[model samples]
Target chain A: MLTKRIIPCLDIHERRVTKGVRFKNNIDLGDPVEMATRYYEEGCDELVFYDITASSERRPIDLEMVREVARAIRIPFAVGGGITSLDDMSAVLLAGAEKVSINTPAVLNPELIEEGARRFGAQCIVLGMDPVRSDNPACPSGYEITIRGFREYTGIDALEWARRAESMGAGEIVVNSVDADGTRAGFELNITRLIAENTGIPVVASGGAGNPRHLAEVFIKAGADAAIVAGMIHTGEYSIAQIKNELHQAGIPVRRHW
Target chain B: MTAIIDYGAGNLTSVKLALQTLGVDALITSDPDRIMAAERIIFPGVGAAGAAMESLRKLGLQEILHTVTSRGTPFLGICLGTQIIFQHSAEDGGVDCLGLLQGQVIRFAPADRRDKVPQMGWNAVSFVREHPVLKGIADGTEFYFVHSYYPVPDDDAAIIGQTGYAGVDFAAVTGRENIAATQFHPEKSGRAGLQLLENFLRWKP
Candidate 1:
């Protein structure tokens, strides 16, 4: 049976793994390779690396860091941030990254997603969405989406954007909630469920994971295909084996190693 | 030495790294001579079938692939490479494929609404038939897969493994003669995936 995945996301800036409060105020963690290897041994299903500085730097993904992490683990890894064109996707794929993620770029130019799916295959292209709750005069739920590390609001509805991404050939959608990120309260189940219900693509819920129960809650209540975690795993609050076991106990159908 | 065909498709780096991890000397090239001279050939692709075929034609690799595969050199196709072995793909209005096997590639349309189209992430596979390529592989082992289209073989005997999606068992692994292909990206599939690659390396055509 297909099971929900527990992914660990590593944010890379200047070749170092870092974690922050709501995608800002970065604090360096450690070497990416070491961190990635640790997660693999801990039984992580997959890994995601976001080059947080790529957009501002105006450069391609950091292939060196990508190579380091790729060399460290055998599990599937995805690289995102500042991916603007097919050439960028090709470069990341050539760097041993299994998948290339597109966020602001895909939102800005929807053709990037289409061309990416055309050139690199749909399965290899992931659309990353950062949604914030906006209570403005227009959007009551604060459903406006943001790009480039929550720096710019695209004024696009999150659910509508997810649907558009699927139509644009996005194979998977990573819904990162700005409100829930770094809060560690839990995943925004309502938002995740909305995206999952609206799109046929696999929805990976990112942000606001605190513990194993949180993982189970998201998988069961939110109807997410996968849950992305970073701080919980990085801080040693939970292990992958423990999370999978808990999910299994809760009837989540996770794959066991033994 | 293994020649990894490089016609501007994605995921060649990981495949090459996997081969190297197994201590096999692997070279990424589009040259027909280099590919023909190798002990084994690996065709790794991650992109549209039509565009990939176009690139292969542009680089004159279609003939090279045909020539090498005919000579009984071990060939392994991964992901999109696997899809291209069929007669045609429904991805881009029926694009012609390499036709190494008798099959047509079609998008996975799950009857269940819960089942996604791409079927991204890891899923378990059950072996339906025994073959050297899957020698040490066990039934009910999970492998990572990310694709929208799956191969529907004309000859059912070509299928070695199958996975259920929305209650329909789909081909996970397909083979004929010296050629074998997997819908999953073995290079990214962890220990089981590595073991499968090892089996391919040791497989006798």
Candidate 2:
């Protein structure tokens, strides 16, 4: 059986690990390499490092930081944010990161996804989207895709975009709910389920993870293959061991070796 | 010295880094001479079968691989490298592979809606028989896997480990004599993965 993944996302701002509520007013948490190593040692299935400010600031991802993190951890990790071209993807993969995620640039060009999948296998390409709930009649799923850190709306339906990205060769889709991001209320089950069921690719439920029970709910109810945790584990209140132990007790299959 | 083959397929840095963590500084190379001269060879790749086969031919590695395996130099394949070792692959409109092993690679046709293509993430491996590379690793230990096509060897003796996914029980580990291959990326599988590589380093067969 394939175990459900528990990934700890490290949102990097100026090479430091930062956390915020709904991507606003983030506080520095320390070195990304240190945090990534800690999470890997604690038995997190995988790791994701997003350069949160790279797209808005219009700069490439910090490759030095990527290289340092790649050296610090033995598990697979994905690097995203400000990955605009194939060269950017190549650099990140060569730096030892397994996958490169494209969000804003992918939405704008769309062909970048195909080219990346063609050059480097689709397994190394991940599509990260920030979707917010909307009541617009145009979006059949009632969720619209947002870009540039959720400050702008594309009016494209989240489910439609996910299907298109999968056809265009995205290996996995990370549905990071903008409305539920960092809220700790719970995962936006409706939207996550909508995308997970509609697409054939692996769906990683991101944003709004509060506890192990919340993760179990997303995995069992929403059909999520993986879930991302930031605030729940980064605050020092809950460790990865506790989270996985709780998931184990709840009967959700997760890797138990630390 | 171990040579990690780089045939312009996909990421080979992580494989080298994994070996580095085990205190073995493996070299990543595309040169046939270096690969032929190495004490061990790790053929690691992530790509389509057609493109990988083309690159392998372009770099003239097919014959080198054949000669190395025949010499019993202890060779290992990972991911795409595993699929390409078979006789043929169904990917990219039916690609004829290296035929190093008597098997054909086929894609998963899952009747279950939840079973996605390119089955990614960790899955447990059930050993059918013992091999030196998997000596210390316990049976039913999980390893990281990310692929759409899997190899089906013609001879069951070649299969050392098996895994079930997408309504198919496929070969997760297969080999004969000195040649062993894994459909999973042991380099990216953390502790258990590193253990497989460490065992490969010390493997005599």
Candidate 3:
């Protein structure tokens, strides 16, 4: 069976795994490479490294740091933040990331999705979307897309944007709810089910996973292929093994080697 | 020397790094000479199967790979590299492939898409029979995979392992004589991935 993925996302800020509530109030955890290695040892299914401040800082992703993390761990890893072009995507892949996640640039220039998939293959291109509720019912999803680190709303309907991304060849979509991000309340399931049910591509529900129960709910009820758990893992509230164990008992299939 | 064939695909560097993690050095090459000269060969591919086959032909590697494997030189293919060893693939709409192995690659049907087409994630595999690659790896050990299409080998003799996805079982690993290939990306499968690669280093098939 295709097991549900328990990915520990490392929000990188200047080479450190930084934490913030709802994408603010930055707090440094430690060296990213070291943290990533620890998570890999804990048996996390995958790792996601987001250069949280890259777009606002106006710089490229830290390739040297990416190389260090890639070398330290052996699992498939995805890198996002400040990935604006094909050159950037290729560089990250060469540095050893299995996939590259694009949020800001993908929305601003949707061609990046098509071009990245064309050059690297669809499986290597991941579309990262930040969605928040919008007023317009005609918006299809009733949620507008946000970019530039969730500071700017693109006014693009989240559901339509996801379908467009898949058409343009995004292999996976990470539907991150800006409203639920860092809130620890639970995932925005309505939107999650809305997007996952709508797109043929696998959907990864991001944000608002405070515990194992939330993870189970997302996988079993929300129809998410994977759930990105950040704050809880970083805060040492639950190890990857513990989370997977809880899920396994809950009848959610997860990889168990350790 | 072990040769890691790079045919304009994705992340060949990471495969080299995985070998390094196993304390094994591999020569990353697109050069047909290096590949032919190596004692062992590892062909890693990611992307469209048609394009992968095209790159192998362009680099003059298709013939060399077939020749080497037939001569009993230990060879391993990963992901798309594994699929290209088959007769045909439905990926780019029934593209003809290297035909080095007796198999046809086909897409998981729309009914199977309930789990998503690519079926990307970690799933356990039970080996059909023990081989050198299964040395330290236990049955049901998890391996990472990312693919839309999977190969269906004509002969059951080539089948070495199987994995079930969305109520459908597929050949996860296939091997015969000197050649072994996996539908999953063992290079990125963490410890189990590296262990399989390490076993490949000492495999004398």
Candidate 2: tens digits of C-alpha lDDT, residues B112-153: 989988899988899999888888787888889999899999
lDDT of 3 by residue, B49-110 (tens): 87888887888987898888888899998999999899999987779999889989988775
**If ranked by lDDT, best first, what sequence of candidates would result?**
2, 3, 1
| lDDT for position B98 in model 3 | 91
Q: Is the docking of candidate 2 incorrect, acceptable, medium or high quality?
A: medium
**DockQ of each model vs. true complex:** 0.56, 0.75, 0.80
Positional deviation of A137 in candidate 2, in angstroms?
Answer: 1.8
Residues A1-258 of candidate 1: C-alpha lDDT, one tens digit per residue? 677888999999988999998767889999889988888877788999998888888977778888877777888889998788888888788777878899998888999998888777778889999998876545444577898788888778888888888898888999999989998999888889988877888999999999889888888887899999988888887888888888889899776752
The weakest ten consecutive residues by lDDT in model 3 chain B span B107-116
Best by DockQ: 3
Best by lDDT: 2
Cα error of candidate 2 at position A62, Å = 0.6
Quality of candidate 1 docking, DockQ: 0.56
Candidate 2 — which residues are off by over 4 angstroms? Answer: none
